[model samples]
Target: MSEPLDPGPFFHGTKADLQIGDLLTAGFRSNYRPEVVMNHIYFTALRDGAGLAAEIAAGDGEPRVYVVEPTGSFEDDPNVTDKKFPGNPTRSYRSVHPIRIVGEVHDWTRLTPEALQQWRDRLATIAQERGEIIN
Candidate 1:
């Protein structure tokens, strides 16, 4: 039998609050534990300028549903004096790009390639503005 899929810790939150630079705890290419779900992603509104208006205006990119890789630490946080266990990993000044949208929080209907493009365009813009995109 195939090993059970491990999606890691569940993120209990509403997708409504997601914004252009907000971090979304979601699976990468696949919904498997091996995927870096913890890495999270930055969200953008749907294309046609149709989505949360506040979120769209908040970003420096075009209005569209997109997500780009935010910075992530290459190593875990180092334990400091007095502090026993290291807290969450630190954020780096780097980013992984080609903003891929595998799925949504509630497993919303799958998006078409065209729809994905709208997202990509927005993400690309965001990455450029932040100067965090890495080919």
Candidate 2:
């Protein structure tokens, strides 16, 4: 395990073999929020294989990194936006943006069903802060 680039409760890693339940951070920029750091979990894949390359088709070229729940403090960060929300907020999975893999998550694979549910609930709360629902 290594120290995360940004502050907060998050797991960070180098771009290696990513798997479901792995929490990762990507560098992203949005019109509303620039130089924003987002966290995502590798939920599923469209292709087959273990490493990121395998997730991409033979000719697709683009890394098909499908993830769930992107949470951030954008709503609370004065640097990112003027709007501030104390609670860390999450946007819909549909709002996922193209990002550069900055770090990978070290913990997450051993989550129990109950633990997973708790995480989901937390994520839902964050999403609602953005006025979006996670299905």
Query: What TM-score fits each model?
Result: 0.23, 0.24
TM-score attained by model 1: 0.23
Local distance difference test, candidate 2: 0.32
RMSD values, in order shown:
14.9, 12.7
Tens digits of per-residue lDDT, candidate 1, 4-117, equal: 222122121122444554554433421112223334332223222223322323334433333334233222212211233344222111123223333334332344568656
Q: Candidate 1 — which residues are off by over 4 angstroms? A: 1-107, 133-135
Which candidate should be chosen as best, given TM-score against the real structure?
Answer: 2
Give the number of the best model, judged by lDDT: 1
lDDT (10s digit) by residue, model 2, range 2-79: 542234222221224555554444443321222334332222211121122222223334233333333532222332
Superposition error at 68 for model 1 (Å): 21
